[model samples]
Target: MLSWVDGRPAELLSVRDRGLAYGDGLFETVAVRGGRPALLERHLARLAEGCARLGLPYDATVLRDELLAFSRQLGEGVAKLILTRGDGLRGYAPPQPAVVRRLLLGGARPAYPAEHAEQGVRLFPCATRLAEQPLLAGLKHLNRLEQVLARSEWQDDEHAEGLMQDASGRVIEGVFSNLFLLKGGVLLTPDLSRCGVAGVMRAELLAQADALGVPCEVRDIDLAELLSADEVFLCNSLYGVWPVRRLQGRDWPVGPLTRKLQAIARDLLDC
Candidate 1:
């Protein structure tokens, strides 16, 4: 494990930091290969958007340099970038003239079972439902208690991921990955405008689908739509793509489209 705080090496954070105090921060989990961060531009773009949405001051150039340096030092692994509103006085109100803080942590790449990507995975149906908050939607903010609770609903190895839905039973995503389904030759994913994390890999796949003339749609997906799909898969920046074979007793074969997009995701992460 390695860590950096504001471009300098450190292992501790201020207790008064708003990120710790009130979850006033955004984070990016990046995959590094050969001393470079995969999907660098997309990660930076999301960070920029999050900073603007949260009214935090940021220097994209500085952050980029720090990320590059951190990844180079890490060599090959997963790098997590955390951007916070720095320390603040005791209150819910954000401090004026906030000084942003950047924290980078690196860890070894996860050794996920190859069968997950090769054969496919089963999903645990989580009872915890996501609350709709358009204001905070799609931003990978520090507040992730919802995900924590949902993930805890499962305590076995049969399921590789948990299926999460919004309060209205609309399928949104997996616990730690974005969800996509293929139906009638169309690649469909849940819209993050109302809730859910807008993953970098999801955006990349949608772009690739468009380039390859694969019909792609971003809209609300209900359980029925997902269950009746021709194929299903999950994606995140870390593991690329995992074809979903089972969910709540329903089974789906790893279809051709899933394979095609999975290959694309693998190539993107590899490069």
Candidate 2:
């Protein structure tokens, strides 16, 4: 694996980096295949939005070009890009003339079970509940303590991912993937306007589902509603879409809508 910092090749990080001091940054995990980064524009757009929300200046065009050049060299893998507010003294105050740092790291494509796509995978109901933060909601920021805590609840790979809910018991999303439920021919995804990351893959499928004449909605979904859905699936840029056959105790057959969307994602993402 290779790493880059601020357009320069490096491996060290200053202890005073705001991203480390106070989680003052945002990141994007992109799926790379055959010298191409999938859904790159969407990833860049989200990262730019996150930077803006966090009062960090960023250039999406420049970052996109950098990613393209880097992905070409890596060929096939995952590219993790972290944009941080550079070195600052020991305090919470924002630094003047922010020295933004862009850290890019490359890793091999993760090998997930093939059956996760064909049949489905099981999901564990997490005990860790997401705290509601409207201001930081939907942005993939550097703070990921909730995910870290939820993920630490389990140690087995039998459950590929864990389902998490908000303090109000609304099923928000998986640890890393976005949640979607098919019910009565309509698609329902959690309204991440108040929490959770509005992932790039989720946005793509929501738009593409409309083009396919599929009815889709973005709203709050509770555990009961999720359990009662016709079909369930989790998605991200890396894995594309994994049909969720089991969550808690509820089981669902990978429905026709999921199959159709999975086919579309596979073709587009090379998943």
Candidate 3:
């Protein structure tokens, strides 16, 4: 494992760090290959937006250069950048002239079953419902208890991912990936404006769908609509894309649109 703290090789953090105490931080999980990071610009862009939304100080240009250099040195794997508001005194009040900390860590890339992408994976409809917080919606912040609970509901290799929903029973996304459905040949992904993480790969696929002359929509998706869909898929930065072959006790053959988008995602990711 490779780790760097504030641009220096170190492993220490004050217990009073706001990120630890109150989940006050933002993180970016990047995929690296051949000594290069994939969708780096997009990840940085989202991180900067998260920092702004959370009122945290960040320098995109400096961070970009630092991460680029770090990714090159780390080579192939996963690089996670955790930016926190540094250590603080007691209470929820943020301190003055906060000293932001950047912790760069690396891990081995995940190796999933090859059939997960080639043939489609099963989905477990999670019982955990996400609470709507427009302020934190779509931002990859430190808080993730909802996903943690949802993920805990299943523990078998048969299901590669679990689907999450909002309090109103509207399907939001997968526990770790974004969700998309195909109905009558049109592409539809849940609107993340209210809940769920706004995935970088989902954004890429939406663009690709448009370029392919396929109709795409971003709105609410109910359980019935999801179950009735012609095809379904999940996406994230690392896995690229995975079709959902089974959900709600029903099975679906990996449809043409899913294959087309999978091909598009592979081309975009150069994987």
- Count of steric clashes across candidates, in order: 0, 0, 0
Q: Pick the candidate with the highest lDDT.
A: 1
User: What lDDT tens digits, residue by residue, belong to model 3 across residues 1-271?
Assistant: 8888888777788788999999989998988887788888889889989999988998988788878888888888888999998999989898887788899998889998999999999999899999999999999999989999999999988999999999999999999999999999789999988889998898888988899899999999899999999998999998889999999898988988888888877775653
Give all candidates' CA lDDT scores. Answer: 0.95, 0.90, 0.90
**Candidates, ranked, TM-score:** 1, 2, 3
> Model 3 Cα displacement at 13 (Å)?
1.8
Q: Give the Å error, residue 131, model 2.
A: 0.4
lDDT of 1 by residue, 1-271 (tens): 8999999999999999999999999999999999999999999999999999999998999999999999999999999999999999998888899999999999999999999999999999999999999999999999999999999998999999999999999999999999999999899999988889999999999999999999899999999999999999999999999999998779999999889989999988886
Give the Cα-based TM-score of candidate 3 against the true structure.
0.97
| Higher-scoring candidate on TM-score, 1 or 3 | 1
lDDT of 3: 0.90
What clash pairs does model 1 have? none
